[model samples]
Target: MRARTLLTWANGTTLAGLAIARATGATIRPGRDGVLIAEGYTRRIPKNTCFTVGSVIFTRRTAEWLLADERTDLFGHESRHVGQYAALGPLFWPAYYLFCGYSYAMTGSYGCRNALEKHAGLHAGGYDPDHPLRPWAARFRRRRSENG
Candidate 1:
């Protein structure tokens, strides 16, 4: 079910979510299903991720970007979760396992090992990659509080 706010009688929105989308190339499109995943037939990604807004698949460079503490590329971990959610909707959990080596990241007690946490870590690494909070984003990996 789509949220009333997400549907403003239109199918697209443009906000100030620049940093995250700019580096990862993830865009915000309007749809009842929520963030539409392009470039695939399956409704879910093939990994383990922290969030559910964007795709999570990453090459060595992206993986290093997620794991590394550097600030070269943008959208470190949190952005990946965004990709996860954008790519996989209902199947984000099972899809997260496809992250390859992210489980070790979220299994600790100090920092974030969940996909969302990781995404935040990456985006907020040495610098702030994006806004502190994505007001426009849905619950993504989790359901809205009103539903429960």
Candidate 2:
């Protein structure tokens, strides 16, 4: 079997086991360009959010695909996530959320300090590292500046 197919299988298996993909009534299919896309979950995931498990992409909106006829910046960004899943296996999701929480605490943005997001090019994924600070973060920053 092709390497890509094997990779997709591995991702799909892990995601299915975790119930991250293949949620009830979800649509699963291979894209024209060979990417595996899954959608239609009843979960309240944010719109336009797309997450990858191994080589399979779980998305709320099918039109949110980063890849198509050619790879865009978002494609390159998400491709890093696929590599991350391949490397981390079932641990990827938990580790990812941990990083997300850390990033949120540090920078008031989920992707700002996330290592994976940084490696994947945060701006490439439409994220701003210097996004406006959260209320608490803003106050902290203001206090630090005043003290300095």
Candidate 3:
């Protein structure tokens, strides 16, 4: 609801996401699949920053870097994700994962990827939000007929 894009990143990547969190006032922590997940994401890693399970917390290393580098836009992105996690609370993670899996299985893509990790790995190279494809994805249902 709050975030439009997600920022997803792999572990061992640069601490850009973490830096963004600290500067923007976000809580960061190690997350599944990727390292962090804010509520929303920058245009970079837009699908791994959404912290669906918990609040936006950052790792110690990353926090340090952000304090040093000083990237305003990146910081703002992670900050948005922190707010998103606060709004969604615990339900966000489970719900998001379930859907992501389904999306991946059905379409061979990660259409349900959160809106935070898009700009995650910007420091190194960057994460493609639409990179992973989920084939055989379930079709969006609007309604159903009574008897056919």
C-alpha local distance difference test of each model:
0.35, 0.65, 0.40
Better of 1 and 3 by TM-score: 3
What lDDT would candidate 2 get against the real structure? Answer: 0.65
Candidate 1 to truth, TM: 0.22
Evaluate model 3: give its lDDT.
Answer: 0.40
* TM-score, one value per model: 0.22, 0.67, 0.39
The residue-by-residue lDDT of candidate 2 on 97-137, one tens digit each, is 99989888877778878888888788877789677767887
Pairing residues by index, what is the TM-score of model 3?
0.39
**Model 1 Cα lDDT, one tens digit per residue, 1-148:** 2342233112122122223344555433332223332211122332222222333222222333333445323334444344444444435545445442344432322223434445546434332334232232334324556666
User: Model 2: clashing residue pairs?
Assistant: none
Model 1: lDDT equals: 0.35
Instruction: In model 3, state the lDDT of residue 143.
Output: 23
For lDDT, candidate 1 versus 2, the one ahead is 2
What tens-digit string does per-residue lDDT give for candidate 3 at 14-45?
A: 24445666565555544332324432233343
